[model samples]
Target chain A: MKIICNGTEYEVGQGTTLLHFLAQLQLDPDTVVVECDTEIIRREAYEGTLLAPGQNLELIRFVGGG
Target chain B: MRIMVHEQEREVAAGTPLSEIAASFPGSDLFIVNGCQVSGAYQPREGDGCWCLRKGEMIQEHELRRLLSLRHTPGVQEVISRAVVGIMGLGGLGSAVAGALARIGTGRLILADYDIVDPTNLNRQHFFVDQIGMKKTEALAANLRRMNPYVDLTLHDCRLTAANIPLLFAGADVLVECFDDPVLKAASFRLALTDMKTMGYVGASGMAGFGDNNLITTVAHRPSVFIVGDGESEAKPGQGLMAPRVGIAAHHQANQVLRILLARAGMLMGL
Candidate 1:
């Protein structure tokens, strides 16, 4: 299935979970906020939140210092 | 013949001038009576409803900054003066942002920080040597009060979580994300998008290390979420966090905060 992450498109397995997809991109699940189709995916549900085709996700991570 | 000013009835002679009363309140030249801007010389008639700008209690320093702010942005200082902004951290970003906001005549602030001033924070954070052992919110509050005694402040010396985010910042117009941890920042952002939907949020990210200054800018990813500073300058071993870079990012956050505050009320004219 194809999904848009931060304006870029990518293809992943059909049943890939947000947790797995984030891990594949080297993004730490504990350190990033994920919004799928404009809905926030809580950390506990990341493993069950399946990414559908054409789903748009915004990933934001905080940096160190102020 | 009863005339109201800020809900207070002032006993004056029938022919007493408005300018006389306006002069009593520093920075209060323009006043509205019954929805119309009246001249200072205009005398109030019976049953007049009036509101005076900059009528709040102010000290000398508060009046000075209020004058400068009103001069720089006409009709804006009052709105900002009545607003309450939440500062989530008391380190580099929160402390600097607090000072800037207070100096600009922000009437009230809701500050929450559990950390204490440490020697390491001396490098980039806003703290004096005497405040090394004091709580972040406590020390910053003292400094702010000294700078502007009239500036109201509410301090929350505890860790902020999603459960308490709504309650803690219920009255704040905008929440500034200045946390240094990635997980906490992300968690706060989550709460900002959900619990605090009506409130505007300005967050900091990628403001680490002594990287390119030009790369640092505010990105409005969402209508309510604006991230300041470059999104790549994470503090690593090679590139350490310098005071200049931290100050730059912190100022960017402050600028965004002012814009959001003004824009929220539709008072931001080309600023």
Candidate 2:
């Protein structure tokens, strides 16, 4: 299955969880907030939430600002 | 050729290189060359005509005004030509803070504001009557640039919403929170803390009313969150800050910022 992460397409195995995909991409889970199809996925559900093909994911990183 | 040193007149060979002029000053630790402070490893070029060098007791340029005046050492002017600081507001406190920072030679400034200058802003804002209808960010940027021509000013004439806050602050080393609204202040604080968690960025708050002067204290350990002014002090609707009081707080904020930068560079220690 394929999914888009940060504007790049990634092919992944079936039944892949968001956390698994993020781990496969070598991204730091703590510093990023994951959004699936414009909806924020809770941190606790990252391990359980499954990703299907063609899913859109946005990873926003927090930066210092005022 | 004529050169102004310590506001006095002096003559050097017309074609003297700046590096040769700098090398002529023996035992001097720093040099203010051509309106920019520099030290160590800067060689003057061929076109570098005679330039002013302001230092102590070198009266070959001009007669000493007074013994006390001769005793006074002009603070070393160190210009950070690459620094980029982001200010969140253009109101009373932000105006004073931005002006002070610009005057002190913060080379780059990014100002963000979504409002328009108003008549009431004349009381404490750094805006003229003609700027009343102008966007606050653009007006403040113009005012700051007019004060210092070397400043590279960018005006983000838009509201700082959560969606764009990270992008706006990505390149800044320090963030100054000058917004007055409680909701906006809280949001900014949260954003700053989150940023600190991810990246090592310094930030500070406070500088609104007059009575809060006593609350201006710099936190020792976490310089990232230097909360100045009384956190508990609240501003009443329709009541704004005065110039003198806000000016003092802004000075403190700028000092803290300088200290933080110096510490990061290993030049300063122990607050």
Clash numbers, per candidate: 0, 1
User: Per-residue error at B104 for model 1, in Å?
Assistant: 0.5
Please provide, for model 2 over B1-271, each residue's C-alpha lDDT reduced to its tens digit, 9 standing for 90 to 100.
5665444555667555455665556655545544455554455443332233446535331222221122222222332444567777878767777887786667577788899999977877788999989999888888887766556787788888656877886787667766666555545555655444332233334444566466755543245556455444444544346666556656666777666655655566774
The superposed Cα distance between candidate 1 and the true structure at residue B56, in angstroms, equals 24
How would you encode candidate 1's per-residue C-alpha lDDT over A1-66 as one tens digit per residue?
789999999999989999999999998887788888888878779999988999999998777767
True contacts kept of 1: 0.74
* TM-score of each predicted structure versus truth: 0.79, 0.57
Worst 10-residue lDDT window for candidate 1 chain B reads B62-71
Ten contiguous residues minimizing lDDT sum, candidate 1 chain A: A57-66
In CAPRI terms, where does candidate 1 land? Answer: medium
User: What stretches of model 1 exceed 4 Å from their correct place?
Assistant: B1-62, B269-271
Worst 10 residues of 2 chain B by lDDT: B61-70
Q: In model 1, which residue pairs have backbone atoms overlapping below 3 Å?
A: none
